[model samples]
Target: MLRATSLSIVLLALCACGSRAPAPQAAGVAAPDARGPTANAGNHAFQAAITADDFAAHVQALASDGFAGRGPGGIGEDRTIEYIKAQFARIGLQPGNGGDWFQTVPMVETTADESAVLGLKVGQTVQQLTFGDDMVVGTRTGQARVSLQDSPLVFVGYGVDAPERDWNDYAGIDVRGKTVVMLVNDPGFHSGDARLFDGERMTWYGRWAYKFEEAARKGAAAALIIHDTAGASYGWDVVRNSWSGPQYDLPAKDDPAPRLPVQGWISGEAADALFKAAGQDLAKLRAAAGRRGFRAVPLEASASLQLASRSVEKHSRNVLGLLPGSDAPDEAIVYMAHWDHLGTHEGGTGDAVYNGAVDNATGVAGILEIAEALRAAPKPPKRSVLFLAVTLEESGLLGSKYYVAHPVIPLAQTVAVINLDAMAPVGKAHDITVVGKGSSQLEDLLKVAADRQKRRLVEESHPAAGYYFRSDHFNFAKAGVPALYIGSGSDLVEGGIAAGEAASRDYNEHRYHKPGDQYDPTTWKLEGIVQDLEAVRSIGETLASSGQWPNWREGSPFRAARDAMRAASVGSR
Candidate 1:
C-alpha cells in the first residue's frame, strides 16, 4: 500500500493573477498516521533503499548555505558538480558516455546592465521605458549592441505557426527586422474550449521562448511577450527575477536559438498601456489571437533597446553514468535531473546560495538515490540505463537542449526520458500528478508502481502552467523522445486536497526561486520526496529491463513524433 508523510509545503507562490495574498491556511489538528500506504515486497525493498531521513540529509546539505544556491558559472557550481560526481561514484555506476562522466556543455553567461532604456516610439511620442518597472529585456545575441528603434512591431496573436491546427499567426505579414509581440499562454487559456491550441493543455506555442524563436526564424529583430500572472504562472516580480539573473545559454554548437537582438517581457500593466497607446484593445486582441489565420497587426510603434552586457564564456558539465544493458546496450532508458539553480546572486538579499532545495536539489538527490538502488539490484536492466545530471536547466533547459542536439548516444536508441524536477516534499499523498500524462506509456508503468503503492493517477491540476515545456525533459520530447515529468500531488494529510493546495499555494508565493527555500526539518517532510522518487525510479528501472520501448498514449501530440522516430529507425537500419 502507498503511504506519504504529507508535510506542509512552504511554496512562496506569487499569484501571477495579481490577486491578493492567498486565503489564510486553516489551522487543522493533526490526523493519525500521516503515512497513506505501506510498501509490499518489491516496493518494500525499493522503499527501504530510499528513506525520508536520508532524503532530508542530502537535500539539507545541497540546499544549505554552503552550496551558495548552486547557480551555474558561480563557485556554487564547483561544489554542486563535485557532489553529483561523488554521488555517482558512491552509487558504483560506470561513466555513462565515453570514458568521462562530464559532458562538457559550453555556455555563455550574459548579464544586462540595468540602467538601459528601450527607446520606444509610438507615433509622435518617443517614450523610453525603464528596465525593471515597464520591461525586462535580454539577448542571446553574441553582439555587443543591438538597436531596434524603427523596427516595425506586430501583434502575432499567440505567435503560433501550427499547420496541423490550421493556425498561423504570422500569415500575410513579413516580420523580418520587426518586433513581434504576442500573448503569453495558449489560445485556449482565454477562450477555454471550442477554440484551437490544445484546448487548455498549453502546447509549446504559448511558451515565451517559442515566441522569440518563431519571431527570430521569421527574421524579426525582436520579440516581446505580454506577461499576465495567470498565463505566465508567476507574477511580474517572478518575471523580473528570472530575467535579471545571470543567464546561461548552450554554445553555438548546441544549436543556440537564433538570438533575437532583444527578447524581453513587458508587464501586463505596461502591455495594457501599450495597447491603449497603439489603439488596439488588449481584450479584443487577445480574442483575435485565438482564431485561425490571425494576422499580425502593426503596432505602428517602434521599440529600440540597447543592452550593455558583460559576456563570459564558461564550460559546465552534464554528469552522466551508464549501466550497460544485457541484450542491447545500444538501446537505453534515461533518467535525468538538472544540477543548476539560481545560484548565489552574491550580496543580493544576503543569500549567496540559491540551494534550489525544492526547485530541484531534491531531484538531483533523487537521481543519486535511484542510481544506488539500481546498482544494488541483482539483475541489470536489459537495455542500458543512462543517468544524467544536466546543467543550466534553470536557464531555458540549455543543457538538455545541447545533449539532444549532440547526443552521446543516438536519440533513436534512446527509448524514454524520466525527469525529476521539484519532487514532492516529505509527505505522503494518495496520488501522484504526472505533468504530461498522456504523452507516453511511461505513465502506465508509473501507474503500475502507483497502484502498487495504492495511489491514484491524478490529472494535472494546473495545465495552464505549461510545466511540461518548462523543464529539461521538454528538450528530449521535442527531439522525439517520450518523457515523463511527474509532480507532487496536492492532497494533504489532515486537509486532503484543501490542505495540500494551501501548502502548494503558499510555497509558490513565498519560497519559489527564492532564498527562503532553504531546507527545514521542522516545517517540511521528506517522506513524500522518497515516495515519489521511488515511484519514478521504479518506472525507469522497469523500462530499462523490459524489451518494450513504451508507447505514447493515443491522441498524444508526442505520439506522432514517437511513431515517426520508430519508422525512421527501421528504415535507417
Candidate 2:
C-alpha cells in the first residue's frame, strides 16, 4: 500500500471529473479534558483526513513479499501481527483486547497427503480418483489417519435441512456410516425461482460450509460436493488450490459441532463418470433435485478413502487497537479486516506465494488508513471504535467466530461491525455494493451516508455466490449483531458498468486466490478506495455518536437472537 502525498495531487491526476478535499488536522493529540465530538465534527475531519496515498502505503506494506503472504503460525504471522501493532501505536490508539494488542486463537493445522487416491465403486467397476485433478479430500476430526471403507454412497440433493423452509433432503433416510454426495448450492439457485428456497438469493443453506455441516448432522461418515462452475461461482481450479494446502480450523475440542470423518469436493468430470457408472445422468438428476419434495436417492455405489494427515495444535494472533469512546467507553463500533492469506506454497510449480493483495491486503490497508484518520480527528467518537485484524478468515472465519464467542466487549454493548474484504483497485464508481443487503437496519445508516456522497447503495450482483456469508461479518450477524459489508461497485463513474464488470471478471478469473494477486503500484487506482473509506468512516462515525442500536430486520434468521439478548438484559437489570 502507498499513501498519496496530497489530495490536490489526487484530484488533478486521479479524479478527472471532481474530488473532495482531504480532512484537516491539528496534528497533536487532544487534551485529557476534551470530550467526544458530535457526529458532524468527526464526519468533517474524517472526510479530509483520509487520503489515497496513505491507503496505498498501508496495502503496499502488508502485501509485501517480506510478510510471506501473512500465513498464520509462521514467520509471516509474526511479521503481520507486528506490522499491525506498530501501525496502531503510530496512530496513537490504545490496546483493544483488555490492554493487550493480541488475542491468541487456538487452531489445529491439518495437511493432507496428496498422493492418496479415492476409491469409487459402482457395481463391478471401481475407479480411482486422483488427488488434485479428480478430487480433493481432508478430515476435520483432527485424526492422524481416517478411513471410510465401503461406505454406501447416496445422492442427497443440495444436502440442506431447513425446518423453516419445510424442506429436508435427508428426510426418512438414515445416512449413518454412509457417504453423501451433494450439489454445490441450494435448490432454487439453479432454477431461478424465488419461491424455491429464496430464488436467486443464496441463503446460509446454499453455502458449502452448511452443506458439510448438514451432512454430518445426519451421521454421514463422509461428504463430497459435486463441482459446478455456475453454481460454485469459481472454477475447479479454485477448489483445487484452496483445498490442496495445509488447512486450519478451530481445534476439535473448541468447536463441539459435529464433523464428518472426511469432507471433500470432486471435479465435474469425476462426478459425471461416477453417475454414468451408477446408470444415471448427472445433469438430469440435478434438474430433478431443484424441485420441491425431492428425496434422497441411493447411488448404487460405495466410496472408500483413507485420509493421511499430520495434525498439529498451534496459536494464531488477532491484532486489535482501540480508540476508546469519551462518553460511553464500554459501548463500541468495530471495523475488521483479515490479515491472513494463502501463504507460501510448499510443494508446487511456478509461483509459490499466494499473495492475497486485493483479497485482503487492500482491506487491512484500508482499515489502517481509517484508523489514522479517526486518531487525527479534532474530537474522539462518543462510542469506542475497535480496529480488529483477525486471522484464519480463509479458514471459515474462525478468528472472527472466536472473537464473537470471547468478545473484547460484550455483544450487547457492541453497536455494529463493519467488514472490508477485497476492495478492488478499480477507479471511482457510481455506487457501492452492499453484500447481503436487506438483512439488517445498519443498511439504513449506510444508505444515508451513501446518499451524502451522491452514491446509491446496490445489492450484491452475484447473490448465488453467497458473498455475504463468505466474509467475517457473517459471524457477527449470526451472533445477533447488525453488521455491514460493502465494496467498490462494479459501475464505474468513468467507464460505466461494462468497464467495472470487466475488471471484476478479470480479477475473479485470473488473479483471485492465485499467485498473480501481487501489488502492482503502476496500474492500481486508489482514488476509488479512498472514496469507499470515506463512506465507511462516515457510517461508523454516525453509529458511534448516536444512541440507537441497529438490529436485524423482521423475518431474518438473526432477529430472534437479538430479541432474546435484549429480553435477557432487561430481566437482569
Task: Give the whole-model CA lDDT for all candidates, comma-separated.
Answer: 0.73, 0.79
Question: How much is the lDDT of residue 531 in candidate 2?
Answer: 86
lDDT of 1: 0.73
lDDT of 2 by residue, 1-573 (tens): 011111111111111000011111112311111222121112222233778766766776677656667778876777778878977886889988897999999998888888989999998789899999999999888899999899999999999998888999998899999999999888998877789887877788988888888899899999999998878766788788777767888887777777888999999999999999999998888988898888999999999888899878988999999999999998899999988887776544566666677868888888888898887788889999999999988777889989998999988888889998888787887788777778889889888878888888887666776677777888998989889888777678777877776676566667777678888989888888888888999888887788888898998889898888877766887
Q: List the candidates' TM-scores in order.
A: 0.89, 0.91
Model 2 residue 495 lDDT?
79
Q: Write candidate 1's Cα lDDT for 492-572 as tens digits.
A: 555677767667656766678776787788888677777787888888787787778787788876678878888899899
Give the clash count for each candidate: 36, 16
TM-score for candidate 1, please give it. 0.89
26: Cα error in model 2, Å: 46
Find the candidate with the highest TM-score and give its number. 2
Where's the lowest-lDDT run of ten residues in candidate 1? 17-26
- Candidate 2 residues lying further than 4 Å off, grouped into runs, are 1-48
